[model samples]
Target: MFAIFLFVPARADAAFCKTGETVTLEGEIIIPPVIDGGEWFWPGKFAKRPCQVTTLRGKGTLPKECAVGKRMSLTGRVLDAGIVTLEVASIRCY
Candidate 1:
């Protein structure tokens, strides 16, 4: 007899953000489950998890077209890599 087990891949918790580094992350915006929680960005195609953005400041406003679950790009400086907080300089929605 043979036994086999298959497992689904776990969601990634670590983001590629580094403090003080400027990066452009493209992903879908997700609303956090908790009340009053800030919106999150899942920074990849088919990403299984989301990263939080503590604050968004600079050139652009949250466009009406960029709603939750919509794909968008955020260009920013990472303020906190642990929590994936970004000082967003620009935003683009598709």
Candidate 2:
């Protein structure tokens, strides 16, 4: 007798973040999920999992559209995924 099996493809995981680096982020900007959960990023893919934004790097300026202490979805490319720094591209209020 012969048997058939199915295999699933694995997706690439985001690189680990560290201090002095940038990272893309999304999901809720909650308070204290981790110290500075809304401030300091947890660092991961927002699409597949939860992510955090620790420092904005003062790249340009704070977003006026999205208010602090509110759930939001953000999309930006990571300059450095290590230690989680992000350059905010777009945001959607929830």
Candidate 3:
């Protein structure tokens, strides 16, 4: 008799961002098609997951170069980790 076992690595369903925690993230800016809608961030090169940006406030203002489809780095406080909501403190376009 012979016994065989398979090994599998654990997978993360969603990126970890604790609520009320300050964090810096790098990603591309995304604008919704609808009017009056806020912006979103698509983190990582391959895993373009959408993270909602509820507000933009704090250190500096959003630059003109930080437009949709442009890659940028931002620091903010996580409002909701489930949907990845952030209240941006600063923004820098790369």
The prediction achieving the highest lDDT against the true structure is 1
Comparison by lDDT, 1 against 3, better one: 1
**For candidate 3, lDDT tens digit of each residue in 22-84?**
777666567522223344433333222333344433333347787778877777787754454
Every candidate's lDDT: 0.55, 0.46, 0.55
lDDT of 1 at 52: 38
For candidate 1, list the clashing residue pairs, or say none.
Answer: none
Least accurate 10 contiguous residues by lDDT in model 2: 31-40
Candidate 1 Cα misplacement greater than 4 A, ranges: 1-11, 32-60, 81-84
RMSD of each: 6.6, 6.7, 6.0
Regions of model 3 farther than 4 Å from truth: 1-14, 30-61, 81-84
TM-score of each: 0.52, 0.37, 0.51
- Global lDDT of model 1: 0.55
Extract clashing residue pairs from model 3.
none
